[model samples]
Target: MSNSLFQPITLGHLTLKNRIVMPPMTRSRASQPGDVANELMATYYAQRAGAGLIVSEGTQISPLGKGYAWTPGIYTPAQIAGWRQVTDAVHREGGVMFVQLWHVGRVTNPDNTGGAQPISASAVKAENVKVFVDNGTDAPGFVDVVAPREMTKADIQQVIAEYRQSALNAIEAGFDGIELHAANGYLINQFIDSESNHRTDEYGGSLENRLRFLDEVVGALVNAIGAERVGVRLAPFTTLNGTVDADPQTTYTAAAALLNRHKIVYLHIAEVDWDDAPDTPMTFKQAIRAQFDGVLIYAGRYFTQQDQAAKAELAIASGLADMIGFGRPFVANPDLPVRLAQGFPVATHDPDTLFGGGEKGLTDYPVYQAAK
Candidate 1:
């Protein structure tokens, strides 16, 4: 049973150290006023370079894309310089990394960007939302989420360009690739949900029409970089925080089919875990596999290895996900693949301070090297 964890896997152009991938986890440590990555954030990412592939935290694509306080962005020159530090460190350690480009859509408050209203596919807002407000270089406050202006055709085209520009910026900052934040209740997801997107134009009504925004953004990223350099994330049926989708099976199936048409890189899907029910309808790792012949990754709340979980391989070995992402397990054990290979006991993850804080529960977590 000596299955290898140090074996290399070719994911498009990047060759990972092993098959392990560090999933995108938001750590709100961006320097204030401009949301630039800092020395602390750089060193923090470097500490976990043992991962075969590191998908850096969800980074804002523009000022309008940010929803939370202290989240890093890739739009500014300073922010690009800051991310360069992070990418350099990860590269120095022989790890491949990708940047997840994000836009919050209606999930934002005007307070975060000096009273700029959030923009969404439609003029709808999440029932309950919170966002960070910058008072000075040091003081950022969290406030209520306000309704966003419904995007006009001009806004749509402008945001697509913003995505293209941000992708170019990510390359300049030394990212090997890019992942679109089309999941959660963010911009792309807002458009995907029939309940959220109530537009009457070409961008709404049917599945194909509703999928126009993602199509445009992804196409722009592919044009900026290349189709082989772009990947996307989706949370098919998440009912989180009063967010609802009409039919997840129809939603994700059509989405998967649509994604197959484009020459993109990979698709990462998350099954929601609300009230203990599966989030993605269809679990069509099989259906998606039948549709798109590309790399697939799946992650959610379930991460245990007792008997290796029969249902786990239903995605990976059974042809749904080419690779699997371990979130909580990776958070606790930096040397996760190593421990998993040897069947070593995993370190317990701390429940407190998952967000909004210092490095106490963050980068200070030691790898097995230090544990020895």
Candidate 2:
């Protein structure tokens, strides 16, 4: 059978050697004191530079955007300098990297935000959701998320400016592009989903109104960076962090149509992967394809080597997706694209050290070595 996963595809100005992507996965391993990116994080990404596109772990756009402890940010000068190390390392290995701009919105605790309350499109709380907070211990585990204050118009405009600034910061850090973290019940997703947004303003109520926040942010990013270098991640059917829309199919299909107007480089769909998670319907997929003309990327659980290959082949062959992203698999296998192409065995990841750790599970995963 023909393998399309290894074929080169052009996404706007960047041409990827393969269809495999390293999606953003927060590891919370940034150097402390300011949540700045560090050498260890740079080493971690450089080790996985074989991926066609490496979307860096979700880096907060500003200090107020942070939801978890130790995750890197792109707002500070030190953070930008630190991320430059990561981008330079990746570039040395002939890899293209995009920093993911993120804001947790209501999915945060005051303990994590220096006594400041979290803000979202609405004041609604994400029930039963928990975020990691440092308690000055070896393991600063999960704590209940706090209810957030409704974002005033001023707050919304400020965040838009911050996002634009963050995009500029990403460029200063030497990143090739940037991805907006608008998925999985984060700040942007909070505004997009009706369940979370209860405001009477123009940013809520109707679908178009709810999408206003996303439109403004994307527009700002496109203005800061070019549209060719910007991408947005969306989780249409995901209930993660209590983000759910009344009509996901209608909502996301409309979203895809709106994004087409901006002519972004790509639209990354974070399909549900958990056990018993709902599968994305074929009709919905077709709707997205019909509406958006840019590159499409899908990420979920493609468990085995065969599964990964088959998914990539089918998606690419059918023109359903331009790229396939593997999250946890990339965590354990830095040279994931090579191992998949060669049918090499993939190592299982350690769940205990998946987040908030040092070299144990971060950069310690060795590349594939042939038996001598």
lDDT of each residue in 127-218, candidate 1, tens digit only:
87666655444334667788889999999998899999999999999999999988988899989888989999899989888888888888
Candidate 2 clashing pairs, residues 3+ apart or interchain: none
List per-prediction Cα lDDT, in the order shown: 0.78, 0.91
Clash number by candidate, in order: 1, 0
Window of ten residues with lowest summed lDDT in model 1: 307-316
Per-residue alpha-carbon lDDT of model 2 for 262-344, expressed as tens digits? 99999999999986777799899899999999999999875555555676678778998889998999989998888888888
Candidate of highest TM-score: 2
Can you tell me which runs of candidate 1 are displaced by over 4 Å?
Answer: 1-7, 132-142, 279-283, 305-314, 369-372
TM-score to true structure, per model: 0.91, 0.98
